[model samples]
Target: MGEEENISVVVATPLVRSQVVTLALLFLAGIVNFLDRSALSIANGPIRQQLHLSATSMGALLSAFSLAYGFAQLPIGPLLDRAGAQRMLGAGLALWSTATALTGAVLGIRSFLALRVLLGLGEAPFFPASLRIVREEFVPQQRGRAIATINISTTLGQGIAPPLLTLLLLRAGWRAMFAMIGGVGLLLAAAWLLLLRRESSVRTPPAPLAETFAGWAALFRVPAIWGLMLGFGGVNYTSWFFIAWLPAYLQTSRGISIKTSGWLAALPFLAGSLGMLLSGVLADRRVRGGAVVARVHRSQVIVGMVLSALSTLLAIRAASLAVAMACICGALLFIHFAGTSAWGYVQAASPRALVATVGSIQNFGSFMIASAAPLLTGWILDRTHAFAGSFLLCAVVALCGAASYILLVKDSLPLSEA
Candidate 1:
């Protein structure tokens, strides 16, 4: 072949083959990650019956995982930057998977709570590591789709977990369900190691202690980071509310059967998956249209958050179950539409070197706020014996998130310079 032909072939080879392989592995890993975490939520009713726990106590149990996950984010960024995503993620998958399996052995609330904490610690590296990998593998222009693609695994896991696990729970029991999900995670971990053997990030030498501290300090100096953090925090409140409580809500509040509730609860997350994919496409087109990266991202987030808030309010006031599900689905769709842009904003704002750090910081703040959702919702339900107030709280938080994107995070300059 001629020189130009030869060059084209070489350019095309690594981009397609390696990128696809890496993303596939990461995507599958993400699905398994969420499946394991969501198992408890799926089986919440059964577990509560067996353990004789109240909503307040169950909320605490759920918070155990989130608290640990949120706290782990504080240190996970530096660990990813120093150790690279490959080892960190592989080890995390193995550890969390093992924790998930062992959850089947828990004899009481205390042991289950401890296992949940372990699960959080093990899974903490996932998103930060994934973000770092995406930054390394994809070009800036393509990053939105790449981010969205991996994120869809989240919705898939959430969407599938309810019905699938409910079936497992009905047939085999919750313990068996945990063991099965955990085994899937372990298999995925091994696959992740094998599939990416040729794919590893070059580990940079650790910075001096003072410099490392300063880098983290610099992150806090950026107002956009804080804005993104707060904005996304509100988004998480909406998401975690559904993730943690939807099945129970349908079963108790809507008077739906557990089996049907499982299927119905999956609808919102399925819609979210679609929204994520569409948002990524729209974000890329906006960038191609000469919009600044920050503006493109913030615009999507602001619009989605506002619509999500409105939809959430409508869901609360929805006249019937069908109407309510439709409204809730719309809310989730818009939340995820903004969710895609939220990560895109993080990537666009941070320099390549600090993608993991920025992502972890965002995760930390988001989870910290999200951690409260289940507990607060439980508390609200206990007090009011209703979901109207709980759904309203989600709407208000989402509106705040929209305001943060519009007013606090300026789109003019990248976060590195801010």
Candidate 2:
């Protein structure tokens, strides 16, 4: 059978109960993953005050996590392909949770920075592993919706973090907040390992090291991979900017209280969750109707990125808080629409055996670009005392990402090649 025919044959099988359970666990794990990442941002003000750090220092502290996370992706991708998601994800959850918990005890910038780096290392395997699971469990036509379902945890965690972490920061303080969140993650890790014990034992045998290296070299030669890398970088540049700075921006720039900022900051992420859901449904429907998978997903990504750029520019220009919030919501909605479609694009564009490797490489490039967002925004705020420049930069990057997808990433990758 041809590649498309093989995919159809896989899709024709009924969805099994184990797949549902696996997806549920993956979703839960994703929520905790983001919650840990966002904790520092939600408590940015308190941490800086307590540690006596400047905005630039705080920005460096934030960037430490992404820098480590991005670099770790290079190795973690190959590890996931060899070791399987069940083992890798469980181990990652445990390591990151320990790092998160240890942050509560740090005395200064250096120690906190170290813990953040560790946290990033621990979290690096998450998306690559999760995407691999989706690829293994679902066929091509169903992967978009499956991936979207997994991606929803990102926005949900972001949406919930502000209010939840704010309450924790207020009631128990930031240290206690980190400790508690880390404790919850540890529990989840144990649960994951136990639950997936059977599934973990059934992985494919490890590929020869030389053959694996050859596969990586071949993937690097594909032109579309470069487009994916740059395009994803644009998406992460905007997404991580909001993830790392939105709460603090509301308080400092808009003169809103932390409590109110916490609530307000959630609006955009909530909208983002909806956007991802919509994109998934739309992509699947079009593909099921005999639309070309790459064309459908790429068009969704391009349109979303363009709209996201426009909305971001408008958001920064809004005169009133309500107007700004509405515009920000619109921006996130479109940005996340692109984000989901981008992952779908990754799924459609990768060889089956190298799905996690491609995802990790894409994530590595994106985060390498994104790691700059927090630092740059912090530097701009310290110098100019405004977010206008930062927002404008994000809008420009989004447009560039749209152009990358439009001009490159033309079709599905060759299935015959690894």
Candidate 3:
């Protein structure tokens, strides 16, 4: 009887078992995304030595990735609406993976910058494709959990990249690490082509490309949505900047050994992974329970981001390594949770048919702004030789994200155009 009841509940829910596999693929793909992003960080030591780069140059490389990644967002949504997730994302994965491997062969900052730009171009479609998949594959109420599960990639990849890639760097050098990641991407892309192609059909069964673009009209008119975008953009700035430069900072300012820095970097990412899974469950329950779902559901993430911002400041201020580590962990927890909410907002605001387009633009804005943060921060560090000031810059960015959410977009779900 109990088994039957459980089956009934599962049956009634939009999270079909088949769809779970689809989400799992999405999650794994996301893991691949971050691992690719972290290739530079994991290999920073050797790359820096090989290229003899200044912090500003390193920062420019990261900025180039963001600049390309940001603009790439524009076309992705429209294409996802037209071509479907399997083909668009599969092609994107191939492009970015190849770009990552190419990074290993680059001779200088200009080549490195060019490769990163290409990498961004290939990576541009990921979130939009995922958004389309979830909307077509899962129910609205179930999206946060599915999105959360997909988010595990961020937690898992970021967590593993620091330590795992570090080991590869130690064993084979940084250039080799890029090759390793690229190889993994090739394998995953093949797997996606074979196993996940079946799931892509649902994302855009009969949806017209024109209809998807038309939906953006509503998005542009929505003030609250802008608030959400601005807030999340702030969070992304801090999180992405830290991701881009933290390794160099640890190596130069914290006086940590290379292997040790990898382990230390793993701490925040690990905390963030746990936070992603936890916040997803919590947000779902609160939303279903009859509370003001909009304000409260988003609050789970907003509050997390706010806390993350505060911890970043604390991390920058700490005099001791232990204190700094503690604060970094604190900030990381919020970053992951904030993602849970930010992505959740995308799930909510986007109509079932137009989700990919909405998600693409939103994330595009975040990354567009993000392109500058790393470059600016790296330049500041190079010029000033002060880690605290760079981190202070980090704190301010996160605070901007928190304020945008609080003051402007305070809803959990988008208004349906009935």
True-structure RMSD, every candidate? 4.9, 2.4, 4.6
Candidate 3 off by > 4 Å: 1-15, 199-218, 412-418
What lDDT would each prediction earn against the true structure?
0.83, 0.85, 0.76
State how far residue 94 of model 3 sits from its true place (Å).
1.2
> In lDDT terms, how accurate is model 1?
0.83
Off by over 4 Å in 2: 1-14, 200-210, 414-418
Q: Clashes per prediction?
A: 0, 0, 2
State the lDDT of candidate 3 residue by residue for 1-418, as single tens digits: 0000001122225556778678777888899999998888777767777889877777888888888988888777777776768778888898999998877788888888889999999988888888777777776568778888888787788888888888988998787888879988988888877886664545444334335446545566666657766776876787787688777778888899889999888888888888888888887776666444345446876788888889988887788888988898888888888877777766665455666776777788788767778788878988889878877877787888788777777454344531
Please give each candidate's TM-score.
0.93, 0.94, 0.91
Best by lDDT: 2
Ranking by lDDT: 2, 1, 3
In candidate 2, how many Å is residue 62 off? 1.1
TM-score of 2: 0.94
Two-way TM-score contest, 2 vs 3, winner: 2
Query: Highest TM-score among the candidates is held by which one?
Result: 2
On the 0 to 100 scale, the lDDT of residue 129 in model 2 is 90
Candidate 1 — which residues are off by over 4 angstroms?
1-15, 198-211, 412-418
Tens-digit lDDT string for candidate 1 (121-195): 999999888888887777656777888988898988889888998999999999999999999899988988777
Looking at model 3, which ten-residue stretch has the lowest summed lDDT? 1-10
The local distance difference test score of model 3 is 0.76
